[model samples]
Target: MEIITINYPLQGLEDKGPIRPKTLAIGHFDGVHKGHQSVIRRAVDVARAEGLEAAVMTFHPHPKEVLGRGSEYTTCLTPLEDKLERFRSLRVDIVYVVTFNLTFAAVSPAAFVDEMLRPLQVKRAVVGFDFSFGAKGAGRAETLRELAGSDMKVDIIEPLMMDGDKVSSTLVREALAGGRPETAEQLLGVPFSLRGTVVKGEGRGRTIGYPTANIQLAGAYVTPRLGVYAVMAELSDGERYSGVLNVGVKPTFHDSLPMPVMEVHLFDYEGDLYGSTVRISFISFLRSEKKFASVQELIEQIGADALKARSVLSAFK
Candidate 1:
C-alpha cells in the first residue's frame, strides 16, 4: 500500500497525478479490531465492484492530544506504524495519514467534502455508525451524504457485537487495562500483542535460574495491568515460543522503580536475544504482581506461574 502524508491546505495532492477513484474507509481505527475489519472489507468489496481504489484515511497524534485533552488519558491501541501495517495486511490500495492540527480541524463540513474528498476522486466513503467529522464534529454520515450529493455514495456500518457487547477500541483498552487479554482477543479476533526490542536488564532473572529478555516497548501503546501472563513471543526471524511474561516494577528486588518493565522468560529457549525485536502476544492472565519477602519465594511462585503458562499456551499450539 502507498502511504501519503497530508497537511492542511492539501497542496499538490491533485497535481502530483491522477489516480483511480477511491472508496475510502475512514476512521481512527485504533485497534483495527473485528469491527474495523468489517468496515474496511466492505470498502474493499465496494471498490472492487465499482472499479475504484480502496483507501483508508486515518489521523495522527490523535485529535485529543492536540486539543488540550490530556495525553495520559489517551492510551493508543496501536501506534501509527502498526496501524499502517494492519491496513496493508487488509490489502488497502492507499492510505492517507492526515496531520491533525488546529487549522485542519477547523475545516467546515462543506469545504471538507468539496475540497478534500472531491480532489481525491472519492466515489464512496465507508465509516462507522458513530463517526463524526468537520470542525467541532458538526458533520454526521447523513450530512456527509448530503454534502457529497449525487456524486458520491456514503456507507455507515452498524455496530458489531461480540459476547453481548459492542466491539470497540474502548472496550478492548478496558479489557487490557484490567488484565483480561483473552477478552480483548475475542473482540480483536487476535491476541493482544506488544512489540519491543530486547534490552539489557539487571540480570536478576538469570541469578534466579529463570533468564528473561527485558523488552523496551517501541511506542506509546497501552500497557496491560501489572501481572504475570501466558504469552507467545515471536523473534525477529519468525520463530515463536511459548512464555511467561511479567509486567511490573520488580517490587521483590527493589524498593521502587521509575517505570514498570516487561520481562519474558521463553520456555525451553536459550540464545542471545539482546538487541533483537520481539513480539509478545498475551494469551491469559495468571496472577497479579506482588512483593515477596525473599528471592527464593519469588522463584518458587515463578515456577508455578511457568507451569500454568505452559498449560495455557499448549492449547494455542
Candidate 2:
C-alpha cells in the first residue's frame, strides 16, 4: 500500500506519475464511525470489482478547526494516526491527506474534479448521502454526478442506522461526554479509546499507593464524563492490560483546577512506562467523581474502584 501526500499546484501530483483510475472515497470522516465506514466499505468494494486502487481523500486540521469557524467541538473519534491505521486495515491502497486551507477551500466544484479527482484518474467516487465539497460545501453528490456525468462514476451511501437512530460521530461524542461508553461503542464498532504517550504527573496517585501512568492526548478528544472508568491499555508492543482510569480533577482533594487529567492504574503490573505511547480503550464507567471527606475516604474509594475494575476485566485476559 502507498501513502502519499499531495500538495497544491495540481501538476506536481504527477511526479509520482499517472496511476490507474482508482476508486476514491472522499469525506471529512472525523470519527470514521460506523456510518462513515459504510461509505468507505462501498468505495473499497467498488474499487475491488473494477480492479483499481482503493484511495481515500481526507483533510487535515479539519476545515472548521482551521477556519476558526463553527462551534469549537471537542475531540475527534479517530485522530489522524488512528484514522490512517483504520484505513490501512481496510486494505486501502493510498490516502491523500489534502491540506485544507482558505485557498484550497475556495476551489470551485468543477475545478476540484478536474484538478484533484481527474488527475488522480478517479473512475468512481463514493461519499455519504449528505457529503459535499468545494468552497463552503457548495457541491453535493448530485452536483458531482452532474459535473462528471457518465464520464466519472459516483455513489452516495445513505446513513447507517442502528436501533433506529443514525450512527454518527456526533452521537458518539455525545455518548462519551455523557459517560456512556457502551453506547459509544455500539456506534463506533469498537470501544472508544484515546492514544497518547505516558508522561510524568504531580505524583499524587503515586503518593496514594496507586501509582499511575499519565497520558498526554491530542485531537479535539472529549474527556468521558468526570469519573472513573474501567479501561484496557494497549502498549506500543501490542501488550494489553486492564486498568482503572480517572478523568477529572482531584475533587476529593479539593483541587479547584478545571484542567481534566487522566490517571491510569494498571492492574497487577508495574514497570517504567514513562514516554511510552499507549492506547486506553474505555470499557465501562465506574462511578461519578465526588468529594471525599478525607484522604482515608479517597483511598477507600480507589480500593473499591480497583475491585470493580478487577471484576470487569476478570474475563478479558
Candidate 3:
C-alpha cells in the first residue's frame, strides 16, 4: 500500500503525473474496528466493481485536539501508525493522511469537494452514517453527495449494531477503561492489546520470585482499569506466552510511583526480555489492584492470580 501525506493546499499530488481514479473510504478510523472495516470493505467492493483503486483518507493529530474541543489527555484507540497498518492489512491501494491544522480545518465544504476530492480523481466515496467534515463539521453525507454532484458517488454505511449497542470507537474505549476487555474484543473482533518496550524496574518482582517485564507503552493508548489481568504477551521474536499482567502502582512496596506500571510475568518462562518490545493482549480482568500489608501477602495473592490466569488461558489452548 502507498501512503501519501498531504498538507492543506494538496501539493505534489500531480507530480506523479496522471493518476487512476480512486474509490475512497474516508474517516478518522481511529480503532479500525468492525464498523470501520465495513466502510473500507464497501469502498473496496465499489472500487472492484468500477475498476478504480481503493483508497482511504484519514487525518492526523485528531481534529478535536486542534480545535481545543477535547481534554489534554484525550488519546486514540489506535494511533496513526497502527491505524495505517490496519489499513494495509485490509489491502487498501492508497492511504491519504491529511494534516489537521487551523488552515485545513477552515476549508469550506464546496472548496473541499472541488479542490481536494475532485482533484484526487475520487470516483466514489464510502463513509459511515455519522461521518462529518468541512469547517465546523458543516458537511454531512447529504452535503457530500450534493457537493460531488453527478460526477462522483457517495455511499453512507448505516451503524453496525451488536448486542443491542452500536459498534464504535467510543464503546471500545469505554470497555477498556472499565476493564471489560472481553466486551471490547466482542465489539472489535479481536483482543484489546497494548504494545510497549520492556524497561528496567525496581527489581521487586524478582525479589519476590516472580520476575516481571516492566513495559513502557509506545503511544497514548487507552489503558485498562488498574487491575491484574489474564493476558498473552507476544515478544519481538514472535514468541507468545500466556501471562498475568498488572496495571497499577505497587502499593505493597512503595508509597507511590511516577506513573502506573504495566508488568507481566510470563508463566513458566525465563529469559532476558529487557529492551525488547512486547504486545500484550488482554484476555480477562482477574482482580482490581489493592494495597497489601506485607510483601509476603502480595506474593501469596500473586500466586493465586497466576493460577487463575493459567486457568483462564487454558481454554485458548
Candidate 4:
C-alpha cells in the first residue's frame, strides 16, 4: 500500500500531472474498530465496482488534540503507524496522512473540496453520518455532498450498534479504561493490544522466580485500567505466548510512582527477549493491583494469578 504524507496547502502534486480518479474513505479512524472497518470496507467495495483506486484520507494528531479541546484527547487508541497497518489490511490502495494544524482547520467545507478533493480527482468519498469538517466543524456529511456537487459523490454510513449500544471509539476507550477488554474486543472485532519494546527493569521478578519482560510503549496510547490481566504476547518472530500482565506500580515494594509500569510473565517461556518488539493483547482482567504484606505473600498470589490466567486464556485458544 502506498502511504502519502500530504502537507498542508496540498503541495508537490503538480509534478504528477493528471491525477487518477479514486474513491476515498475519509475520517479520523482512531481505532479502525468495527464501525470504522464497515466504512472502509464500503469504500473499497465502491472503488472495485466503479473501477477506481481505493484510497483513504486520515488526519494526524487528531483535531481535538490540535484544537486544545480537552486533555483526554491527547493519547490515542492507535498511533499513525498502527492506523496505516489497519488501512492496508482493509486493502486500501493509498493512504493520505493529512497534517491537521491551525491553518488547515480553517478551510471551509466548499474550499476543502475545491482545494483538496477536486485536485486529487476524488470521485466518491465514504464517511460516517456524524462526520464534520471546516472551521468549528460547521460542515456535516450532507454539507460535504452539497459542497462537492458534481465534482464528487458522498456516502454516509450510519452508526453501528452492539447490544443496543453504539459502536464507537469513545465506547472502546471507556471499556479499556474500565478493564473490560472483552467488551472492547467485541467493539474492535479483535483483542485490545499494546505494542512495545522489551526493556530492562530491576531484576526483582527473576529473584521471585517469575521473570517478566518490562515493556516501553511504542507511542502515546491510552493506558488500560491499572491492574493485572490475562494477556498474550506476540514477539517479533511471530511467536505468541499467553501470560499474566501487570499494569501498575509495584505497590508492594515501592511508593506510588508517577507512571505505571507494564510487565508480563509469559507462561512456559524462557528466553532473552530484551530489545524485542512484543504486542500484548489483553484477554481478561484478573485482579486489581494491591500491596501485599510480605514478598512471599505477593509471590504466592502471583502463582495463583498465573493459574487463573492460564485457565481463562485456554478458551481463547
Q: Among these predicted structures, which one has the highest lDDT?
A: 4
Error of 4 at 76 (Å): 0.8
Candidate 4 lDDT by residue in tens digits, 1-317? 88888866899976745578999999999999999999999999999999999999999989999999978779888998888888999999999899999999998887888888988889999999989998899999999989878768999999999999889999999999999999999999889887999999998999999999999999899899999999998999999899999999999989888899999999999889999999999999999999999999999999999999999999755
Clashes of 3: 0
Which regions of candidate 4 are displaced past 4 Å? 14-18
Residue-by-residue lDDT tens digits, candidate 3, 260-311: 8899999978889989999999999999999998888999999999999999
* Model 3 lDDT on a 0 to 1 scale: 0.91
Best by TM-score: 4
User: How much is 164 displaced in model 2, in angstroms?
Assistant: 1.9
- lDDT scores of the candidates, listed in order: 0.91, 0.86, 0.91, 0.92
lDDT of 2 by residue, 1-317 (tens): 67777655465665776778789999878777888888888889988988988999998868887777756343567878888888887888889988887888888898898888987889999988888888888999889988887778899888898889888877988899899999998888888988988999888888889999988885557677989999999998899999999998877765686688888999977789999999999999999988898988899999999999999988788
> Candidate 4: TM-score?
0.98
TM-score of candidate 2 against the unseen true structure: 0.95
RMSD of 3: 1.4
**Which regions of candidate 1 are displaced past 4 Å?**
14-16, 70-73
Error of 1 at 285 (Å): 0.4
* Cα displacement (Å) at residue 78, model 2: 1.7
Instruction: Give the better candidate number (2 or 3) by TM-score.
Output: 3
Q: What are the TM-scores, per candidate, against the unseen true structure? A: 0.97, 0.95, 0.96, 0.98
- Return the number of clashes found in candidate 1: 0
Residue 262 displacement in candidate 2 (angstroms) = 0.5
